[model samples]
Target: MSPSELMPIGVFARRCGLTSSALRFYADSGLLPPAEVDPVSGYRFYGAEQLTRATALRQLREIAMPLPGVEAVLAAEAGEASRLVDAHVAKIVGDASAALRKAADVMSSLGGAPALPIAALKGPVLADAVEQVLTATAHDPSLPVLGALRVEADLEAVTLTATDRYRLSTRTLVPSAPPGRTWAGTVSGDDLRTAACHIRRSALVRLEAGPHGIWFRTTGREDRYARLLTEEFPDHRLVLDSLGTVTGRATVSKEPFLRALEEQPGERVELRLSGRAVEVRPAGGRHPGIALPATTTGAPLRVRFELTTLHPAVSTAIGPDVMLDLRGHDQPVTIRSADRGDLTTLAMPVNPSHGPRR
Candidate 1:
């Protein structure tokens, strides 16, 4: 509190990573008032105790936090301060995404290209489908299109599909209004994820395709845009068409099936399908596994899958019951809702392997 112990404005600024003028500005704003003032000479001095707050203020400002936000963050408790910081970062990211989309739209307009109508869909349904199908996407630096969602639309329905080589998921959504014509594009999955929240809140969404991007013009929410990838998406249809006939089939309650998988001790899981039960057990292990009551038909069979590939496919099913169709031991298994076949996932089984001992 003594004048001799106080640091002059220049020294304080140097130590705190702020300019002298910034100190004065914050002082005037009542955020970082100096420890002492030489009234006659109008000199300002700050104490060492103020360094922590000044340093935090500088760091907050570096992130472009507004004055009011900076003030609130500074005054908040530790937990609240952390939450505020996260919220601020989220807003910045959302703003940056929106700005980038707007810039792209502006550039697109300068080219004088017309926006073509793609399709119209129910907001909640489209949102759900996007979330479900996107689970199949993977981050592969070598092939970016694999990280995107392939959207194909026709007069009858619009289909969303994505694949990560190991798993392929697709859902067909009946459009509220038919498309102007048939259309297809691979959209950035990250952009779609960011737009999902807004899409879900609206009653309807009209999709408009431009040269470089697609727009989700919602009925009562802000329009969102997603960039289209130029890289070619994999020919998922080939895999679908080449699928072998199912040799074994089982319909089981989804909740119990998922629970059994959850309690499995290993990364590889084996499913044994017989007369009226599906045994979920760790792969290649002697452990007696959990069995769920199921209605199974066709030949008895056992199939193994990586837990990573199988869990999401079943968890995203629409209803209480899931139907699994198996072609053979090393084939891609088909998973879909027992009653509603609109959404389907094909999960590839890995080679038979031993699971960790219980």
Candidate 2:
């Protein structure tokens, strides 16, 4: 038998969030064959070590990826599924945003400008969600509750977006699926920014929205959502997309890269934009080429980059590595680890003068 992580069928079922019968179904279908079968008692045994892979399989199922597709993704080297996930998030975010804009325009025409309370805004984003909002709001503070913002939740996720315009950042939701599927809600961007500071990651939030001001009261908490003008936010998508010039590969530690971008007194490096390597020389030093596990079919690439703009790209990593997408360059390059979620940083190339060129 192939060496594999195994667990008893019953124990594995609870961890995988699948029923024993369903596991048997997987084995029957040859989707996930168990390690061994008990001859005497007619029972199944799964390797405990396979739990992570099994759980990943279930998550893919939750997202509705087909069985064959799911198997293909899992069977590939790690991070393949994560890349698929990032692509999915981008596509969905775009489609959902369009639907939301249409819904807002309709609401405006009907005379009911939406008002999303601070409470409603707080619930949509999960851990590090506050950090997510703060990244965009760092330059501006003191958000006021506008009341007519938008909030939405589809089966797999939820979203909070405000269109005060100069900038818009949407907090994409993952499945928390607590008690309130019925608690579908919305809130202004300002309310969200202001309130994120006090919102508890573990508490259930109750929302009350009206023409006056929205109220976000938790069952046993003392938190209030922050409401700020969406107008103050720069068109972050555009801003983020338009940043930096020249693109190339730079290998660095995920932890250091994260801190360098996220912490104050941000790391300053003299960007020596070369054709291939975008060398990330720290203020005090230079590190070796960060050899990473990867899956790609290309020549060893080196390039130059605009050091200033790489920070935001690095800090926003939901995973580990950055998918450095370089347009406007001699050739566009996308880099990441062998596994999908392994990359957390993403960089986009800009025109020489810090503006987007097409």
Candidate 3:
């Protein structure tokens, strides 16, 4: 055959039926670079060699392998490349299976029928209530809810919580949870994790609490039943405070907090409460305290929050404002949420009780 025509980016996009944006993305990702770029104009040009790579990349992406992963496969040695491709194929198969399972459940719900494995839940309406609370309440995997529930509506709401000692779970039937009187539940401290495992296929999910467990059931399956747990659960509320009472809301620079702890672990980050601003100063004031550039509203209470407890939560805080509610001295500070549900209500003892006594 005669030599194939060398294609430019525009020609490659047209022939491949892809978009210019996609071509640029591939080029930037190290998967395919243009043959040349006009020095002054900076216009990208492509050669035929890249077409092969582009075609293969499109196929790999179709198989659900991400761009970075594709690069790994391409760069890997012969034997290693084979193993990587095998792993990629296995992931694709597993992902497809999961997708099918979800589709089937959706169809079943749409048909107004109970999803399969309905027998997995067998208990009482009380179980449904526990499922509601344990499902709604903030959860920490370090603490899990070992309970079940039954419902009697097309929707319900539940709160789930655990205390290494006991678990408390409750549900609300305000037309939010499942229609039936029963469902299973789990608890976790991670939202991304909760979405993956729990909260599968259903509408109206208010992540008012921590993520831990999940309950899967068909929509409009009201006659459903649930198993019950007749055990006492520790009162997390008593151990914790309400979210509204949180008056302290300060915006601190996250970078310095990391540096302070790195300089000296176990040292407290002193937060001096004045009017509406709390200066986050390092212990002993060796490193000058950094006044939060932002604003806040709360009681003028001077407190020292542990760097260990504060750092991790602040690092993972959803947005700019790290709202801290320190109402009770010994109570855990409530980490305010500006999103769907409460992000974290961390129980922190009053910082002053353990004074700076070295």
Candidate 1 residue pairs in backbone clash = none
Candidate 3 local accuracy as lDDT?
Answer: 0.49
The 0-to-1 C-alpha lDDT of every candidate, in the order given, reads 0.92, 0.48, 0.49
- Measured with C-alpha atoms, the lDDT of residue 272 in candidate 2 is 31
**CA deviation > 4 Å runs, candidate 2:** 1-127, 138-156, 160-171, 175-194, 207-209, 212-214, 228-253, 256-278, 282-308, 328-350, 353-358
Best by TM-score: 1
Score residue 37 of candidate 1 by CA lDDT: 93
> Which 10-residue window in model 3 sums to the lowest lDDT?
204-213
Task: Name the regions of candidate 3 deviating beyond 4 angstroms.
Answer: 1-179, 182-233, 240-267, 338-341, 353-358
Q: How far is candidate 3 from the true structure (C-alpha RMSD, Å)?
A: 15.5
| lDDT per residue as tens, model 2, 322-350 | 44544334232333432443222233333
TM-score of 3: 0.39
Span of ten consecutive residues with least summed lDDT in model 2:
289-298
Error of 1 at 67 (Å): 14
**Candidate 1 lDDT by residue in tens digits, 10-127:** 9999999999999999999999999989999999999999999999999999999999999999999999999999999999998889797788768776887787898888899999
Residue 279 shift from truth in candidate 2, angstroms: 3.8
* Candidate 2 to native Cα RMSD, angstroms: 19.3
* Total backbone clashes of candidate 1, pairs 3 or more residues apart or in separate chains: 0
